[model samples]
Target: MDLVGNLYLPEDFDANKKYKAIVGASPFPQVKEQVLGTYGPEMAKRGFVFLAFDYLGMGDSPALAGEFKQSRYMFRLIENTWDAVSYLGTLPYVEEIYGLGVCQGGSIIASAAVTDHRIKKLATVSGMMAADPFQWTDKDVAHQMIAAANISAQKIYETGEPDYVAPFGLNDDQSKEEFVSAAAYPAMAGESYDYYGRDGFRGPKAVENFSNMHIGDQAMQSLFSLCEHYADKIVQPTLVVYGQDAPTAICSTAFIDRLTNDPEVSAFGGFSHVDFYYKPEAVEKSADTVAAFFNK
Candidate 1:
């Protein structure tokens, strides 16, 4: 299957000179234009060829046969990351390829780098590195998520039509204020509404081919990827950056805790989780740090 992507090259990019490359994995349910779009250019400006792409069934990429759109299966994303690394290998000017993952993408790159030596270095900004705690924190909620996924999986098997659901609680019609007012999502995921909601700085409508919904069955596989568990296996030089005050800060901390190799941690006090998405200061800080780390 063909995967759609955008490659950001430095303004001074020369065909004759070899340059290091970075493959960026984006946040959950987010297209390449969302977080990656913001960082890809920044990294390129800092002297690396940055590649950002939509996984199968996301954005402009079509789903594989027997699969429906918005199917973000955990394992499939890793395979897609590998394919992206392979793509970088085809570029004559690329030297050592690196991986820069934001939010869920961080976990993805780390998982891929576990054995894929192609990715020489790794960096994650406000990463949702350990997903199980967020999904399995409450036993009842966990069962409910599983039951919903089971039902959706069964329906797809029988009907061949994908059942889509907003992974986040808010509806497309709902504004972030409304969601916050009603206390729709009390968990850390609620912070996401500020970015994914219709009123967000860059909502689904703002980014082409983006929707807040994903195949309902994705939860089954999504909840099972314990990236922190495999952190010890990842030997690449890694950098973990996030907002120290953000509730999701634990994700980076937890991930770093399990990393056998010493990782550079940048938990800034003023920034929040979503701040790294579009906030210029946060993005620049994170991007510059990542570029420096990869370059080092």
Candidate 2:
């Protein structure tokens, strides 16, 4: 689909020189301008080229033919990663290519890397690699999520218009002030909301095409994107990083345990899963750690 992307080059980018490159897979429903935006420059500053793109149906990339933007079907996202790796190979200056995934992006890259050895190494920051949370953890919630996805899909078929909802069980109508003042961030009581509703840090005011809603059918797609089921098959050197106190840390910890390789882990204190997205300290430390791992 000729996916849209933003490639961040090192300050002294030289066409004649071969440099290691990193292809970043972003969290679910996020464009290249969000988490990738925060880390791309940092990776570039560290002497690497970073490629961040919108998955086929998300962000600025063209949606699947006849499908809606933000459809974000899981299988297509993996194919998009493979296509991104192909794009990196086209650059004569790119030496080694690596994969970096944030949140669900981690799962996406790993699922892609299973057969695409073109990606030499792998790294995941606050990755939600395990599927149990969304698939088997609670049968009732899983059934409920599946039901909602079915209804959303049928609505589109019946009305020929996309249905958007706050996937994280957020009130799509709430004001930004209301979200900022919120005492607790109930991390997706349902499945997802658009790219913004989770944290006040990056909301509608922060970027274009920003919204608290996404296609309601995404809940069904996430079930097929998990990586832990095949983590043992991955032989590439891997580095896993996450906020120690983050509720979702289990996603990373459990994933690393399933890896066949003796993967490295960097558990930083005082940062949550979302902190690595843009918080100064979290980004600084996490990026440095990821850069070091890729450099090694």
Best by TM-score: 1
| lDDT (CA) per prediction | 0.87, 0.83
Tens digits of per-residue lDDT for model 1, 239-294:
99999998788888878888998899988989888999999999989988998899
Per residue, candidate 2 scores C-alpha lDDT tens digits across 1-296 of: 58999999999799999999999998866788888998999999999999999887777888866688767878888999999999999999999999999999999999999889999999999998875763567888888989999999899989988898777645545654554455355443211222365444555556666555789888888866457889999989999999888888888888877898899999999887788888789999999999899988
Taking all chains together, the TM-score of candidate 2 against the true structure is: 0.92
Which runs in model 2 stand beyond 4 Å of their true positions?
171-173, 176-199
User: What's model 1's TM-score?
Assistant: 0.96
TM-scores for all predictions: 0.96, 0.92
Q: Best lDDT goes to which candidate?
A: 1
- Residue pairs with clashing backbones, model 1: none
